[model samples]
Target: MKDNASLLRRKDAATPRGVGVMAPFFVSRAENAELWDVEGRRFIDFAGGIAVLNTGHRHPKVVAAVKAQLDAFTHSAYQVVPYEGYVALAERLNRLTPGAFPKKTTFFSTGAEAIENAVKIARAATGRSGVIAFSGAFHGRTMMGMALTGKVVPYKTGFGPFPPEVYHVPFPTALHGVSVEDTLKALQLLFKADIEPKRVAAILIEPVQGEGGFYVAPPELMRALRRLCDEHGILLIADEIQTGFARTGKWFAMDHHEVAPDLMTTAKSLAGGFPLSAVTGRAEVMDAPAPGGLGGTYAGNPMSIAAAHAVLDVIEEEGLVQRANQLGERMRGRLEALKTRVPQMAEVRGLGAMLAVEFCAPGGHTPDPDFTRAVQARALERGLMLLTCGVYANVLRFLFPLTIPEPVFAEGLSLLESALTG
Candidate 1:
């Protein structure tokens, strides 16, 4: 096999530059919280495949379920020949997600598809077309998803002619100078300026903005948005694609708030490491779309569905929700201690294990992307992987698996501290 550099050269020659890559090495194998590169170099995995491996890679239960399903069949195409696993997984999600009222769920192949379908369901249910998203929000990479996303740099740069009737308002963040009241007022102004309240079908938000930095939505802000959606008859869609499935110390991030969304879109970690996404919502709203209008050819592949069921089981059996909280507390404590030594460490924030540390210039609020890059590069050189996010790319977010062994987690932290202090 070629070395890391040679393989990277081959990758650059074959893959498009638009698909950004954070690491130069190619992974050969991964377990729990560690990965080995093609060249046999070992590293601690802090990125967790961008938060898609909350249960870790190739978990025993998840792999066993996939193997069992593969023996039976691979692609029956749920839409063509409906499968029981698909319905069962949907039922589990309906019961687990943050709502008590009757709900229904439908699966998709990606997060972007689930977002599109949720929007369609909301529009059909309310007979409206407009959608209200927030600044710094990230929905997905698809046309409609990009339309709803707030950032404009990489995701929306040449992607003009996005779907219409989509508008963005400020997402409240203390670091960004936006307040909850300011955002709510902006929503009202958007109704008066761009689209009417009644014409808006839904307001989509990430309970915790994922790529925009791990900014947790204020409880008051969630309550206000719920109220606004109720008054305007607009559906509330929680884009929990990043914060779902025990990443935030709960089954769903919305559980952190007392409010409930009418519709929710989830993916990423839904099927452990498999490609599966789901849109779960109120039964009546979900049924708004005609039966045939929804669903895809590979909507809920049996393997992915089986994997999801096992992933849920693993989460429960391993007490991952509680484990996430414990891991988050330990990491946050370490970051906080490092903050005392590194003045550039502007903030350490997130819910449960879904945490991040932001960097800024000393004695100023300016985002220090350069410093963030240095930390990431240093950590990688020390055999630890890290991911940088935020609009300015100055925040280093941590998504290590909850199943990571204590010694491995401690070693990653020590490497992180060295990177930060060195």
Candidate 2:
């Protein structure tokens, strides 16, 4: 078997530098919340494959579902032959997602596709082209996704001139001094100075900014956006790509809000580890797209659809939504108690298991990405895998599996404490 070093050298030689890898080691195999490297060393997974493993790796239900799907047929492009699993999954999402009106859903192969399609549907439905997004929001890597994404260093560095007519406003962050009123004011200014409200097709937002940092969108901000959308005939799109499934202690983050979105994008943990994304929205809006206007060749692959069905079964049967709250409460309690000793731990925020701790310089608000990196390094040294996010790269977000075992979860937290205070 090739060791990690040898495989890494091969990888570097074969793959482009743009595809970043976090861990030094390469995995040989993974189970629920744990993995062994090519060198046969074990590590506890807290990153959850960047929030793609809410039900954990190789979950029996998901695995079995995929196996069964394999024994059946693999693909005859969804748009070609079509499949019942795709329609069934769509039906489930339509019923599960927060909305009372008649809804329709379309599947895609990735979150970026879902986002791009959502924008297309909105434009077709509203007969408008301008769209609005927020700062610190991460949509995806495609042209439109990159256009809508707020951060620029890595995602949008050399990738312009991107799709035009995409506008951005500051998202509210109380810790960073940007308020809800400030964001609303920026939107108003954008409509006045940039694009008028009548030309805007949609206002896209992440209920909780994902790659930007795990800053939960304030309820006030959500309500205000809904009102603005309603007044202007703009469709409100909630990008629940990272915060979907049971990560936020809710089926969807929008479930926590009083108002519902006109359309929603979901991916990441939607099909356990499989590559599947979906755009679910109002039936009328979805129908705006002419026949054959949407869908991809691999959009709603049978294997991924089956896995998604099993994932839903696991979440319901295992009670992962409530489990998320339980895990988040315990993790928050631990971080809150450790704050006294770890002065650099500036803020502990997130909803349910979708939590993050932002680090800052001692006794000050300046971001300390160095300290954040140090904590992550120490955690990895102790076999606990972690991931960092935020525009400043100063926040450590936790995406642990909701199905993690008690003993393993406790051990991971213990290792995390040592990493923070050590």
Candidate 3:
């Protein structure tokens, strides 16, 4: 059998350095919330493949659906032949996503593709070129995605000459000392100086910032953006790529707010580990783009569509939405209790199962990325996997599968506490 060390040597030579990997070991197989490396070392998964396995790795239903699809047909180029599963999944999303108005849905291969196409649809519908995003928000890594992303270091560093007509404003975060009023004022100034509201095609935001540190977008901010979009004829786009599929205790993060977005990008856990994404929007807005203008060769792969259908079925039948809330509350309580012992724990915040804990210098507000890295390292040493986020790399976010067994979840949490306290 090929050992992990040998595989690592091979990987170093075969893969480019641009694709950064977290875990040192090579995954041999995974199931639900656990995985085994090439050496057969078992570890509890807390990252959930960066929020791509909300239903867990190789969910039985998802696997069964894909296997069934494989027997029928595999790739027919959705744009050419098209299939019923694609349309069925789209129909499910239209009804499932938040919004009382008539909606339409289209598929894509990745979250970034959904964002790019949403931009096109918004521009076509509004006849505008300007798009407004917020700081500490993560859209994707594509050219247009990079332009809209708020972070600069890794995502936007070497990749320059990004798409133009994209502007950014501060996102409200009490920990960062930015307030809603401050964000609103910055938008006004942006309109007065950089781009007018009339020229804006859309204002894109993550209902819960993913790569930007899992900060939940304030409800007041959502309400203000809705009003501003209404006054300016700009479409509101919600990037729910990482927060979709009951991860945030809801089907979509936007569902937690009273107002609904004009267009929403959903992926990651949407297809239960399958490479599938979608953009759902108001019917008229979605119809703006000419039929031939949208879609890709593998936009809605039959296998992915079939898996998505099973994913939706599992979510409904198993009540993962409610499970998320239950798990989040339990985890939050444990973390809160531990905060008394660990002075570096700055904050514990998130909605439902989509929670994160920020670390800071002892008794100080300064971020402590060193300590965060230490905790992650310690967890990995003890057979647990964790992921870090935040602009400062000082936040540890939890993305455990909602369907994790109680005994396994408890074991993972115990390991996590030891790592944090040690």
- What TM-score, to 2 decimals, does candidate 2 have? 0.99
RMSD of each: 0.8, 0.7, 0.7
Model 1 per-residue lDDT tens digits across residues 171-194: 998976889989989988888888
Arrange candidates by lDDT, highest first: which order? Answer: 2, 3, 1
In candidate 2, residue 216 scores what lDDT?
92
Clashing pairs in 2: none
Q: Measured by TM-score, how close is model 3 to the native structure?
A: 0.99
Per-residue lDDT over 127-234 for candidate 2, one digit per residue giving the tens place of the 0 to 100 score? 999999999989999999999999997899998999999999998988889999999999999988999999999999999999998999999999999999999999
Report every candidate's CA lDDT: 0.93, 0.96, 0.94
Candidate 2 regions exceeding 4 Å error are none
Candidate 3 lDDT (Cα, 0 to 1): 0.94
